[model samples]
Target: MEFELWYLLLVPVLFGAGWFSRSFDIKEKKSVADETQTLYKGLDLLLDNKKDQALNSLVNLAKIDPDTVELHFALGTLYRKRGDYDRAVKIHNHLYNRADLSKKERARALFSLGQDYLKAGLWDRAEDSFRKTADLESDYKVRAIKELVNIYESEKEWLKAIDEAHILEKVTGETYPSRISHLYCELTLQCMFFKKFDEAAHYLQQAIHADPNNKRALIMQGTMLQKQGKLDEAVEVWKQVGKISPEYETLVVASVADTLLKAGKDADAVRYLESVAEKGINSDSVDAAVDWICKIEGPENALEFLRRYLSQKKSLIGFKRLTDLRLAQDPDNKELKELSDFLKNQIDKTVRYKCNKCGFVTKSFQWQCPGCRNWDSFAPVRSEDPSRI
Candidate 1:
């Protein structure tokens, strides 16, 4: 009878424990459901382009569940995209320092932190983070190396950029010859600035080896040769550039003429200019040829040459040149001077080097587009549309 009484007393205690356990489970499930609802709300807000609200919701969720790695990544990326680099760095740095993060997650976090630093213009910190990230065996390794190349390029560390580019080429099993060639060309220019002719020539050779068709390298080679008193060799090298691309012939015409003039070959210079003009290449070349003709041949011959050239090409710039020549010959002609002024204004407003990728326009050529950060993106010919400018 005593044993039965003890068992009856224990049954109430057991039922009380069971009731508390069931209550705790219900609360835990409710908490999970609320977290899920918050996540969905955040996603909806993001999809609706309410990034501020979405960020708030995600911040709250992160506070509730700090272990959600993917959530932190999303929040960090959103912060970076929104130009909140400090917050983005904080979140990503926290994830990177976490002992519980897997190797891949740590790499991702470090890479993200690098991006934050880069966007914030903290080059040294970004370089450190990306270098460390590149050492890790993860998907971000190649990207980290690429960022390193960009950083070096931006900092004018041409040798370092070339090294990083080579590493990238090896990693991706593809050739970035053109990019590498440009980097070497940059190094060559640096060397040339210090009058290090020997080193400059070596770098030029490397540049050509990297990309034989690099026009900049060829142009630089010609300049270096000219500086070394090899006028004939320089002229020959400049001619090769025209063979590569006839449209690019204008770039070398002035150089060729100057070099020939230095060698007392005035007739040769005039002939070269005339040949370039007869091709009906572009406005700059035609204008150059007309100016040379006026100086060497005479105004009458220049007029005849320009009229025939304009008839063939019908260039606004050529027309402007013709107007200027006419205005010079008849100084008191009010209509001609007015027409010249109008054409000058129109050409100034319309002619620009436009980036093919981003439509960025500039008065001068740029190997890399400032707007889009793309190499070789500028059109070879000047754009004559005011709308593009």
Candidate 2:
């Protein structure tokens, strides 16, 4: 009778245990289903271009699964994309400092933290992070080196930038001749700033050797020659730019004209400038040629030259010059003054230097695009239509 009573008690105990196990399985499956549903909802929101909503949805999901490493990375990236660098740094820093993370995951977190620092203008921290990331054995090594190169360039550490650039070239199997050449030119300019002519010459040679087709280096060479009182040599060097790149010929026209004029070669200056204007009838070349013509000849002759040039090319700048001369000759003409004013407004609206890489427009020319950080991406010509750009 005691054995039968014990057996009955054991049966209730076993039944209770089975009931608890079944309940736990159902709850676990529900939790997993909720997580999956939230993930898919977030992805759908992202696909719908609702980034803010998607971010919110993922943030809630992350709250439930605090140990989700990839989810944290996604959150960090979203924060960075939204320009919330503080949160981005927080998320990635937490990930990077986690003791349980794999080496590759830690490397990725550090690289992302470096990017956040970079975008926040925290240069020292960014450099340190990237340096550490580069030391890690991971796929981010090349990217880390590239960031280091950018930082070095920004800080004017030309030697360091050159070294990193060489590493990038070797690793990527892609030559960075233009970028290296520009760095050398920067070194040359720095040397010249302190009147270190010999050092400047050496660096300039390095620049040319890095990229023989570097127009800025050639231009600087001419300027250096002119500074050394070698007018003929300067003129010769500047003229070579026209041969190498005719589109860039206008860049040297003013320098050539000034050098020739300094040497009492007024007629040669006029002839050379006129030829440049004839070759390229853009605003810069035309305005340059007209100014010199007005000084050497008379306003009437300049006006006459504009008339003929406008007949062939039909440039708005050339027409504006024509109206200006006409108004000067007869200042009382209201019609002419109004026409000039209208043209000036129109030119101001349209005239700008545009970057081909990023379509960044600026009033002045830049060697490197601020929008894309690309070198030599801006065409030398002034764009007359922003729409086309």
**Which regions of candidate 1 deviate over 4 angstroms?**
1-22
lDDT of 1 by residue, 202-305 (tens): 99999999998888888888998898899999999999988987877777888898899899999998889789878878888777778877887888888888
Cα lDDT tens digits, model 2, 1-389, are: 34666678889899999999999999999998999999999999999989899999999999989999999999999888888999999999999999999999999999999999999999999999999999888999999999999999889999899999998898879999999999999999899889898999999999999998899999999998999999999999889988888777768888998899999999998898778767754777777777777877779878877777887887677888889998999999999999999988888888888999998999888888988888899877887884532
By TM-score, the best candidate is 1
* Cα-based lDDT at residue 238, candidate 1: 91
What is the lDDT, from 0 to 100, of the residue 25 in candidate 1?
99
**How high a TM-score does candidate 1 get?**
0.91
Compared with the true structure, all predictions reach lDDT values of 0.90, 0.89
Pairs that collide in candidate 1 are none
**Each candidate structure's count of clashing pairs:** 0, 0
RMSD of model 2, in Å? 3.0
Q: Model 2, which residues run further than 4 Å from truth? A: 1-14, 47-53, 386-389
